[model samples]
Target: MKRILCTTALTVGALIAALGLPAGAAQADSTPRIDLRVLVVSDGGPSTDAIAAELDTAGTPYTEIDLTAADRPVIDAELLADTVDGRPRAKYQAVVLPSDNPFAANSTEMAALVAYEQTYGIPQVDAYTYARPEAGLQYPDYSGSLDGVRAEVTDAGRAGPFGYLDGSVPFEDNSPSVGESYAYLAQPAAGADFTAYVDAAVPGTSQRGSLVGEYRHDGRRELVVTFVYNQYQQQFRLLARGIVEWMTGGVHLGASRNYFAVHVDDVFAADDRWNSELNCTPGDVDCPDGAGTPDPIRMVPDDVDHAVDWQEDHDFTLDMAYNGAGSVDHREDHNGVDHLTDKLVADRSRFRWINHTYTHAFLGCEQDTTVVPWRCATETDGSVRWVGRTAVVDEIATNRAWGESVGLPLENDELVTGEHSGLKVLPQQPDDNPNLAPALTDTGIAWLASDNSRDPRQRQVGPATTVPRYPMNVFYNAGRAAEQVDEYNWIYTSRAQGGSGICEDYPETSTCLAEPLDTATGYAEYIVPLETATALGHVLSNDPKPHFIHQSNLAEDRIAYPVLNGVLDGYDALFAANTPVVNLRMKAIGTELQRRAAWQGALRDGRVTAYRVGGTVTVEAPDGVAVTATMPTGTTLAGTAFGEAYAGERSGWTPSHGAPLTLALPSSAAQATGTAEPASATDPAPATRVPEGTREYTAAH
Candidate 1:
């Protein structure tokens, strides 16, 4: 029999007495059980979808009932709770509704949901509800645009669910001409049991009103949110964690952490410079003849020193994707000595290094660059001619051998092909080079880097699993701020705006710039912030994909710093020290993605089970499968403390060795407060008409 562990001992008689039960009525096995799952009832709205997205990112299992669907399951007591082997079982630990009430006031579904929450002490989230008496708030005293508003997390919020944040939640206002945020901010209703978690000062008034708060009435609790938002908004992303933690009482069947890592490609190589006259790099396909020999941008020894110092100052490490042949070529040209390579090798231990192949060769099909846009070379038989497997293997092996010779720290199993070649290139090389996978297998590579923009999903190339990387917009050939901005304008601006009109041609994926940017000031003022925001979004979304830039960005003007610093600084301002960014290596990130896939499959297949009964949480899964969980700080597993603390809770991944994994919750867990006060006998007033301008806000979502 599987044993259940509890931090404190309690006899059946004591439990019965505590419950005021008859002497023979209660048994040791009759403890109420709460399943570790969430129930989301969506009304095809962005707010509810945002919450659902958060749950998915955190790896939490939830059942979503689409109200718009004709065949949706009815919300009834039988579906919410049942008896399991003589134990009372609550099917879901928490509930999320589209609003305070999406159903008719006296509907049976609403009645059943209320009764279920009351009986199980489960919390409910009123996702994007109006701030009316029905939701424990007065009709909005101030309701309108809240763009650029800097809201505060009250003391109650800090002591409760929003402790991870550093007191402020600033709404994003990306454009001045457009309204990005709208909310109905209001005070609590008279005699209502309500407490605000987040609030902002009303414009033109000294009074503060709630945007997010808890409402309690009629023996039920609801976390009422008054603002409109979607999944991608920064304000929503910051508050998502607190919302879930509050609803789940800080215990859930999944985990999340903000992750960020950057890979600097072509570390030892020189990138051909962009030509302002030709509007392209001379060495690239688009340049005309007589565009002139390429003036390559290579980092000097001082640049290497600056990189090491910058890494130390920022408290971050960069993965240098080096090309060994670049250094060899430089030595042959410069009296058999390359000072930049010598300096980097001397300080090589300061940064992580990855194999970028020997000469950054294109491992894909043979290229026919005779045309304006290149295509794969074909034989007379019309079959694609490929770069042989031997060439690919030599490139990888030669790089590894050179790194070993120089004592550079390296992981032999990790490889990044030049330009993420060898894989499919649309309209050019439709399929992967047949020789590439075999070459990877020969090199014993287990993790290969691929471009996330081209192929976002991780797929197998021989024995290697591709690690998708985000390509930063910072151009590979740009070594100066002016050059970077010039290229950006050309790709994004319309032909009417003196650009190549690419953005106009592909309207969906690329938005045309209204006008050309001033190249001198654009890199610092616009590009840095835009790129930083994009990268930060990935970090906040629990994505572990590493962002990549060419080494040129780190040399010359060092334009990448402003963007990197902006991301770190923005994160620092939002999160407290308890929740720092998780920087991981490429291999570790790939492993994380693999584990998540397996764990999610187990959940979807119903092969894993988890539940909380009193102070004991039980988890069971197939042998060798790791289970991720977030629990109270002092919770323990196998008689030892469970996981590392983050955002006021302990969470991590642990393997289930074919036995039931039991967690003993701390005694303090029993004293944790609910999201709202205990239920009262009074009913709230019926909701009134929403404040003026509310319809416009609702429609925006």
Candidate 2:
């Protein structure tokens, strides 16, 4: 029997009970259970006061298990699953490392955490973890201090966590700094409204403030730094709760493609910050200014550019799909898939090639046993297949082979998805191929592609029923929802397969693309037909759907989703013309004037509607009156909060209207199509029902 460790004595309820502030009505403990414990790998101040206050109010008990804490809470190596002795310490939920050493050093024993994660299922966060990425050093050039306005009342009765960082969150290299990070906080446990603690840059600083590292691992959140949290306390109280609630369960992969996942397959071919000079001219070497560096011009329809001719003209970043096959025609010179042991590069630009595989082996399929070389074996349809563990292991070994093929040497930091340079990317939905998942782990591939067999919905309905797949493929939606309701699309997957889609008969699923647009004249796949679906109530309101166009998938959509994206741009123009923007990038829409107003009016009347995930909560007040609120089911509040909408200036908006998917958009045609729709009632019935085998995947949507 597994033993349950007792709660840390530092918990808010225990703290509140110890405080003895009471009445005839005793306050219930509101601390939530899905524990979010933080372990400061590197010691020092990031100021946990703000976050702690918010968590306390929200009744979320988080233990600060400082690996470097002077008076650190007792933790066990066993607690950490470290071979070294330390038992009592394993009592918390997740372990958070704020600095470099904590993440890199103790993380030296990574297998321990892997075991712990496998056994206890605890997620560990490595926030702002150090180790010179460029120089491959242990720290940055030096340390920097973050400044902020001292609050009038420290722990203002608040709930949840939220904040912004105009100033830095001071920390030494490899040090764990605790600072306020949530956008708002509402201590529902106490009867107080909310608090806006972390807000605004002091009188002056520099350009825009930024967040260093923030991410969720294994469904557990590990905030590397708190650039912005509790900036506006009460007014945005609900938002604060929403942020923390989101953080608590790790980062929940949202329901749709808006949760874009960019592949950080190779180090930035440029400096850092996920940007690359791969777009730079051959010898010019005049690296584009970071700001001037276009937000990756994604060729919706990708194509291979043997040289810089087209890329230089369009200012597009060229992707050298490192292939062994191409090598057959080209040997050491030819560079396409045939052997995993060998592959090719794009001359000097080969530095930018994303290492998917030496040969594009869609890991889940089967290969011929009798064939001497795996590549020689093909399914009856001429599809390359692989089904053995040895081949999978060979696939894993290919990473090292590719690394050797290229010049990159692997390191520990390489494993952690490099704090994913982009925040809007959202969290990855678990893995689809469990075997692939292990291979990814074995080869340090945190991000892998899900073989979405052209459902277009990116859904996985059924092993028993319709069990949604994890880390479901987020298909690049080129345009707005208003434009793509019911469109018949010939999705481009493997160019070798002539971009299979609804019309084509696939070998595995048998079904083809059948995503319904819910149009008046039934469902259709034409652009005009699909765009017309929105008017028919399938998509109410003129507001565009929350669509995400990742830097990678943009290559595919450019080709297959030309019309959808082109038309969506038109809808974008229309929606922005309307003041209150309903759905868009949440961060971009958070304006200063609005942020100020929300900050000024904390715990507002009608403006704030409260909700949370766990049944528990913690609250505290100036009077020392603490109250805890508990609910059985989780929470949600419909309707908008920023009040009236703003049809901001739409002068610059220009819709990119083009011919539908039938016509190929240049560039993107080269990259494989990335998303797949779910099997539908509309698809022609298959000859064979999918055989029941072992199957499991989390519902990411």
Candidate 3:
């Protein structure tokens, strides 16, 4: 009979109680029992953090066991007999050893753990490595120094572990401070499964070495990896995440291919009348007295055509949000409508059209209570009130109607408010704006774009799902040119004072003729961080979406064009190097966003719990909360989460894996409910407040 040495004082009764299972829930002794335990054996190093980070990113629940704890003694024969869950073999599906030479300093502990591992047959991952004869882990070649080598993935490597790669991935030398490095250069042992190899020759020799290798020991899979966890390279992070997935026998839930969508807001027909305005202020240095007017040679429909052609040439799609003020006329150049709309209609396949709102209304206000009633009429009532239920409905309908009238279909059904004016409700709560729910539902717009980090609660408002953009688009508010310039300068140059490098020429006075807008500066200040965020899976929104640009960017001699070009150039450069980045239109991304939001809501609402049993993973939602997950091929899915009929059943052949499958209980109809308590006049605006109305707005309508 096996004895249980209970750490954390958890008994079968305790676990059953904690899991809310009935007293008789445990199956008969002869039944195969599945467990969700992953043993993390670490000395509290970066490798440990790296493992934890990937687990967190995947939303996988895990319990960490620290090896370097001062109070805990080293492993001995007695402890090994009762190690972890106290089964003769530890009751864990997998084990993560932070270092390659896990038994380096402590031979006794190492031998004890090694015996337990061989008996248990649990798969293991060794994240760090070094030559250790005592541990029987050796690098025979013994380069004796870390190599600045490029890491290339092998064919088996792609299929065995990482869900991220279909082809090879390279970790290139990015910076002097933290060059691409492999800690140990070792030859693969005989019959070992070598997964990855370093391309660089070991010091003064025409011989490269294995960077990652795997093999079986005692009927268990063992993976050896080499990559500095703290180097903070995007590729390193990606690999680390993939390794965790491999260890846990799980795959990422959604998005088979890596892609990004670009959302261009305030896309009106070419506005030749309004040129790119030059910032001429009262500041002592750069301004010519009262010389603010700019030449009217602004972007036209032809410019938009050229830009679209450029994107098409590069095989990319764009999402354009239009405010329906422009009309199309067929009579000569005197057509009452904007030609851009006509051009967009002609080039429908290249773009996805979005409704921006009729006439770019302000949807929020400052310090106004009951100012924008939901049933207001007229711009004064709407703007003064700063967003009411009626105004929001009207804004969305009017703009959508305009798009249809201009022969451009509003197929996306996504609304980005003109000016991103938040909907200041008749009754505002500090945490939620339940009032906007009805307006959103009435407009039939399921996806809404916001600015200034809106929707901190990450909850849906009625029928509307709000998506927020961050880091502020350069042309979001054209009037704030000086502020935008200053911010960019600080971001680009490492200078203590915020000045663009152009000021180097103006030695006596720190002034330039105009704000700096160049590709090189823009790439460093804006595009690189954006790309980094995308690669890390946290761009403007919580997940990777397109970097937002504006229609105004297409204007000749405008800041938008150069910045947009820089973004595309960076994207192209990365793509050329074989990094997977799909350039998609917003319509596709918005649909995906809706699915992601719904899935996120299910998790946050505490309605679902996911865990694994044996080789089968189970998703439990006792409250009939819909449960949906995207699991890889080969795994079987069943139970109430799949369907009541399939409860306690197995999926017949693995259900085809695709986008994240959403399991959701039916939602109740949205009500025109007031907040539990309205926000006090003195209180700061609620985070979900739309980006309109405030003077510091950072979104284009």
Candidate 4:
């Protein structure tokens, strides 16, 4: 079992005695204590699971005490317990009550929980049932017959957590008698303040009552709602997140941020040869030398424009990795390149420009000095020799300059390597080009993209911070052969088809296929499902890296745009409409990671672990590094050592390096606040530089 080093409200002497530490020892090994964690009292219902999943996605620390089908004895004993691992179990700053019956008023478990809430003023969330005679528990005045009912937000609820709510929900389902019941039927006590109310057909009709309410008993506060926790419903999920944030006091954590991005690679001129073909026959006129290749595959102006328009329509931000040298065949004054850049620059709000490289320089290639074209140096190992540092700088500087000249203003210190093939160093001569670091650093490039499928060591070669991108979807390599096409289809289609041996012809016209058949060449497959799968993959893995695609995917006639649209649509259904899956650029994501990397747990001098337990976030940065904290709502700054409020959240002034920081909230605020730490006083740095040779690399768009 993993041991949790705990520091509770108990004194150090008491903790030492409990843990059998040396009596005279100065202190423990400075391993930071878990200041606080959210406690969940659940009955293992789907609703509880939904809430837990949200917390997990947010990276919130929580411990669940499963009481599913347990009697009062088991539930009461657990709640009454004072300590676990020599730390007070009651130290949980916030408690979640997903089940109405588990902690319903007057039950033995409920009594213990109520005592804890009253004493510590810990914020609690009560879903569905509250005080009720039907369940043999009664507190204030909660009374109602159990049923389904529709609700409307009251003027008061609009100012509370349910502010996003609008219209009668579950618009598809409605009760024959009650019209539409977006919520479960429940009644609020007399003292409870209603945020929402069940509406009657007429203004003063009978059936109208409280649907959502906040109850303050003595010093305890609980948000009571009648709706089930359904993650698929956007409103429910939004409300749940809002409720949690409100309870904690809107404390977004640096490490716990949900990260997202979408990078479109090879933002150059469209391939004129791209076409919708169906088959590759031996003697077919279109099949040149029987090699199944895309014909007339170039992206026309409409294709690029349509893609940009679609993304704009959805309000989706995209990262465009521009190759300054344009296509190899059309490098000298490519009108397509100019047109594409002009269009992209015109809609700067929807695109983040990235440096792909001046020429798509594969650093693995040792330039063939004798040849007029770029060529690789094939040494004895079948691998190209290392290109020197100067070559690296020229590639970066040239591309950035070109992008800026074209008004793209490519993000400085951020790059997506051409072909997603990052810098390579041969195994035999690992120490050959130590200059790659200084080269990238010199050009102000600090972030690089990598594929998750590659070996970690192979991907970690370059000096820049590596951002891992999903390697599931095809970027530009649409295979032009029978075998490659079948293999591609097998990966995505096989799951629904059971296996891929259903089609015999080059362009299999079978109904069992999951993708649409691309007639231009059977090799070109509609990868809408594949795109969706990639998005789902990143979400489940809890990796916030954006889903990546090549410029080919956006070609008007090809399968990429449709696939991308379908993927985004699926996200809307699963999450919320027009939600920014990841709104940050490559550089911003990199900086956030760096800030989080500086602190380990809540220890060290660089960054302190601030916990939002009561009113104030106790910042424990003894070696103060400008600790910033959100001021709790309904509270004002007190005259203490806590510094200025630069960006809304109270932040400490930059003191000399080793000064200690200890923030104390006003007594009233502490009594009323939840577990959310307040906002940061200092704004995040605009961009972060990887200090020389750090091996850290964040996944990019």
Candidate 5:
């Protein structure tokens, strides 16, 4: 098997095979390791068989993109390119071929396959069938009638050796050879290794069925297992499995991550927030909410719309973190459910718990035109009031205490405030910001959601006018207001990203003036973004990305995200690749921060040097070019060597001390020299080119 070479944690290959993985080794519950993608290739055949064989042996799961699954082949080709969804197959450690025709039989089909491959950069196996009858073989095509066949140990050794046996084998489900097998004609390319071991051969035909070879595609490894029907006499399956494992980098992360939010505010008592199904509840005979109803699989549809309504739904509990004083018996208990403690015990995985408050408050102080309306705020003192510092701390404590009760540390719960009243939506000034850093620190909260796409040059918070609560698991207003009772039926219930007023379409509950789409579309996209983000988040965590909300979210009866779902549907196309399609969970972010912090700490300790170039930062841990790739390109990455690449374009800093106020870009660019390395302590250049350079400055390493 190909060995992984990295200085981080033990290479996964060595770790898993060495002594198996410790349960706690990869036990962190949040992470997705791959850059997942999917490609719906041709119908099944040998190429498909070869790919499936590798995936099965490696134990990697991928999404399948079958055009036949659609009534009409109208899927977006972009998402289908080496990806069923937005995730890329190449991102995975290993991937399987969707069909035998590795390349299209004609120019049109070839173009499609190439495009798909461009999107995904993982090793793929080709069964004898990938050779298109019409298109000449792109790789070495091997096919021959069975001739000389015999099993034997290898004698090719010339020096010290590992006890590797030599023999021909067959796969578990081997069928008659349907076509010819192909390999990259280049065989072993530069900076890559390839080998073709031959066990037996037929006259004037194919051999090396169980042989191993290596190739490279865009700096990634590709292992080729030539499958000539007569290549081996025995042990073909073993050889194939080994090759598959090697091709996929032989590493497996986690399975998947599902994201969703359950509202838990004042509207626990539902009125119209459900589907209007005609006689589906209450009455004994004709109106029974039974399991085998019309939509048997869908537990709760529009008709059975109730918070945590199981009449026709799955086992899901809506989140209930609000102003109930954490005690159901308290008069201030806006939520009847014992939200603090018992809620987690009832169902920890049922729904996502977003932080509203020990008590809730209206966000932004804006009046909802709908007479007596609902805002982010909740009832306290019998009326809505600003949930300032005390409320924030109380909310954090209550949520943390509840999570601890359920065996789920509040550490995993990223705090998200609901009453954007003005925070998540607008760029709150230090004076305007209701929850200042002092309050935030007091709450010990780790996460926060934004309401709008401000200057795009923001970190703590900036110009965004409103929260882009779309594609989100929770929306504050869904449980509020009596007129929009239909809100409960949908998983996503907020205005579009940066949409308009509480009632305006783009900016309102209708369309959310802040973003695209009307209420329905906004709501739908919101649902999609959650699953998508969760999946993406998992990847960031290097954990298994959860399968999207497959079966109508546990108890939340919201329909799934469609457009975004379709975009994500393709993620499954690379099941064989052991791809890590995950989301950017707070835990993963924290871990990454910890890693970088340690690395930076070492730099400060004179153990290494760090440099910030274009969109990437290079951490030279005494070794040259050890790790350097694109980082999260947000506004925060502007001043430090790690974040300077992203900051070069923003207008925040003014150059000083002979150091030109500019980005370290290519010499061809204006005011750039393509030589922007972090200056030594004695160097006169400034530490960073970020706006607040003085605040973010550091001594040269």
Candidate 6:
């Protein structure tokens, strides 16, 4: 019996040795504290820049080392990690390199990075790299332009990082002549531990090659991407989230969502129609004087009904920026009753309403239209004469009062001035009217809309904060498709092409049209796709800025619907049900921007500290600041489920309120480690075990 007992003890000791654990160890060890920051090594390339942009947009903190900089910091083991209070601590949760190997082969810097990643059990991302044996891939079977290719997310990918997608990722082919995308298609190297995440069929072949995959070798893991792309490309935007999640293990210091909102300006008002015959509007500034009668475009009762139905069908709401003075003028002209106003008022609850002032008055410096192209009016002393405060107050108050009288739901804090006036206008009024700020404060306005084309940054105007809005190219003066196409051609075509030469003079901002567009099909074919692409870019960029169009586009032929529909449909095709378009009201959008600004400032100032140890995450921030994070579904805050679930993860902003925010993660949560086990030979890799030494230290400490 003594010999048998000794044999049992000896067997147990051998088992522990095989598992790489100390004697009497019962389980794998816990990971050391890993800081929630990314390290980016850039070569000034577009692919690296694109990833950095994604990190910035999500409010994720990162330290970038430029390869071209003369005084760039060196990569070393000491820089990557150190001991904190007798415990090993990793300084970065992930590393992003310009390529798989940016340094010389077998260089100390490269060896240091590999050792750091292996020691911390952290992942590395190769932003863009070629298909070669060094990257654990066979030479390219097919290489060159990837434009118009339709790639697929593998089943393994669907179960892993790329699951947010519903399989298909179509590359854009904007112009036939330009090679917009390029990639190399290759298979995994023989006997390599590689798992393809995103792939496409090699040209003229039945076998598929990996475009994105994971390569595990020499106790380190890397996310290898074999394509060239920039920040603006649709394909890159679609895959950026997955890439970030894979690098950071879906536990990071920031969150992202797709947002879109539309504001229809000049509601209940008339817009001057473009004159195709005279090549400009018959207004005071640029047309032949008295060339034709002024014909304005206004929405009819039928148009109001169609708008409500369209909103219901699309599950979206439009913010109608109305000028109550237009209804007052119509009432006086039609014996004090107007059908369009009555229809809109009866269905007022169907849409959001913003105070657009009493009339569409230019609230900037008084205009001097005596000379062509207009200028600011001057005082007797040659000083700039400004519009007074009373005029601005009346415009805001009268519109609010009018809306209330009609039982229209309104928020007094939101305001969009006529033509975004009372603010600066280039070349004519270079400064805001001195009266605008005081008027806004008196009227209790908190959020004011500014044209992104002119003022793209949010700024203070007394008690009010500016909310920059995108101006849709759907012209305010256009009421019909043919009229819209005619004006677009007039603005974009060259003077030699019998149109304005503005595109030639300002090539940076405007691209001259190849030729005149056909008025019959141009609005539907050319203009709609171009505008839709631009708007979609904003939505995918985590931007919350609202887009503004004129009520005239919803009148007459209702030309704006096609572009709006294109944007909606295109988004649906690209994203899965887990990710929905976040449509926010003006106030809500303003608040989101405000929070982002504060959070980004906090990150920039190094006031935020976040990390994960074992099954718990901790975040610290200054008082009144909010913390944003994306974590696993089972993560909890203060004993309750945390964040709204989207794209297979939970993410939201939690107010710190001058306290530490601690999250309790479930037992199944992925834990960081000092060293991880090799991936298995399977389609989906298994979670690696934490090294035993760290766990023993954690147990002791």
Residue 54's lDDT within candidate 6 is: 91
Q: Arrange candidates by TM-score, highest first: which order?
A: 1, 6, 3, 4, 5, 2
User: Which stretches in model 2 have alpha-carbon errors above 4 Å?
Assistant: 1-354, 365-386, 407-441, 452-701
Residue 697, model 3: Cα distance from true site in angstroms: 36
Clashing pairs in 1: none
lDDT assessment of candidate 1? 0.83
Q: Global lDDT of each model?
A: 0.83, 0.27, 0.46, 0.48, 0.32, 0.83
Q: How accurate locally is residue 131 in candidate 3, as Cα lDDT from 0 to 100? A: 31
Which whole-number lDDT from 0 to 100 does residue 536 have in model 1?
94
Q: Which 10 consecutive residues of model 2 have the lowest summed lDDT? A: 251-260
Candidate 1 residues 331-350, lDDT tens each?
A: 99999999999999999989
TM-score of each: 0.91, 0.26, 0.64, 0.60, 0.34, 0.91
Q: After superposition, how far is residue 423 of candidate 5 from its true place, in Å?
A: 3.1
Q: Least lDDT summed over 10 consecutive residues: which range in candidate 3?
A: 666-675
Candidate 1 wrong stretches, greater than 4 Å: 1-30, 288-290, 671-701
Candidate 2 per-residue lDDT over residues 142-246, each given as its tens digit: 233333332211121111222111111221121135443331111111222212232233224422222222232332223333233232222122223323332
Error (Å) of candidate 5 at residue 500 is: 12
Global fold similarity of model 3 (TM-score): 0.64
Q: State the weakest 10-residue window (summed lDDT) of model 6.
A: 1-10
For TM-score, the strongest prediction is 1
- Give the alpha carbon lDDT tens digit for every residue of 1-701 in model 4: 00011213545465344434455532422222223445666766556656556555444445566665343224432333233223332445567777444654567667666655554456676654544433222242223322332345555554444333443432223124653223434344444443332221212345455445555544556666554544443334434554555455444232222245678777763432322243232222223443555442344456656766777776777788877676433535554345554555576555778888877665544545443223456779876566677887788898888777767755688887665543443332333345567777788777877655442322334557766666545535442333334445553344455344445333444434646344345543344454555465454333555557666556644555555566566555443222235567876665544433333232222233334333434444435333333342233434444443322233223332443333455554543333234333221111111122111111220
Model number with the top lDDT = 1
